[model samples]
Target: MSQLGKFITIILATSTLALTGCASKNKKSQVMVAPLGVGHGGNMGGYYGGPLVNNSDAIRNAARNIQGVVYFDFDSDAIKPEAARILDQQAQFLNSNQGARVQVAGHTDERGTREYNMSLGERRAAAVRSYLAGKGVNTANIEIISFGEEQPAATGSNEAAWSKNRRAELSY
Candidate 1:
């Protein structure tokens, strides 16, 4: 090879060796990240310097204890007295964890038309967002979605099921 060709070849060889050496020696140590679910994506959780643990079960269990649910009255988006207390606790949580985000999902009973129920659900979610904002929680961190009557807490046409259905759920 000519002088220039030999220099280029040497550079390429060095780069290949350096890159290969930098590769992880243990194939088993490689981490495979699962695809993110629906919403504004990217690693919103930020970086964790520590080793990752598969604590999904723990998270699922602890989620039940987190009181982020608020019930509403029939055909009303207004925050009920009982719901206000629940919201207050949620507000406290959000206030303490400023970086935490929440998804407010509104649900309605199977009574009104799909369109009407969807609108009502949106209003319910908006009301919850407003209440949280009032309680010093950052509105920017809150996202609202209306599921309407599609996903009912209790499947029935009776008042008992209807009452359970009308609510907004907050998920972090």
Candidate 2:
């Protein structure tokens, strides 16, 4: 291209960024991640680091469709036996990639108050975290967050939707 064309392209890009406050066009897929300490069942509430979650396209693509999600029953935080297989897979993936980190997001159906749902979400996330830890994944590479009822997986107030909503998603 000519210099004039290159100049115009740069100008347009700068104008768009200035108007939009420098936001990227990509969609964000996970929550903020804090690093954890390198130990299990510690005195630090079992958590161990950070202000943000930084992910590369390579890591994200590698973890894509790895079936790292575990669902839960309505109003329950217990890890069901059927979920063990996928949880073990997730743990193995993480253990193999020592530098890779994953975020565990807990979600609940809109069947209870916001406060109650939030607590349930936390429990669900913790349960998943514990399971991963037991499977030999480093606790330091796992971060947890609770989305509660705010981010339902499915719309509507039906059994199908509720069942889909009660899940914990692992994002790397």
Local distance difference test scores for all models: 0.74, 0.77
Clashes of 1: 0
Clashing pairs in 1: none
| Winning candidate number (lDDT) | 2
What clash count goes with each model?
A: 0, 6
Sliding window of 10 residues with minimal summed lDDT for model 1? 29-38
> Which residue pairs clash within candidate 2?
34-49, 34-50, 35-49, 35-50, 36-48, 37-48
Residues 100-156, candidate 1, lDDT per residue (tens digit)? 667787888989887788788888988998999999998877777777776778877
lDDT of 2 by residue, 1-172 (tens): 9999999999999999788884556744233322233332432212244423456778788888589779999999899987888888888888877778888888899899877877788888888988999988887778778767767678898999999999998888
- What TM-score do all the candidates reach, one by one? 0.64, 0.68
**lDDT score of model 2?**
0.77
Model 2 alpha-carbon miss at residue 73, Å = 0.5
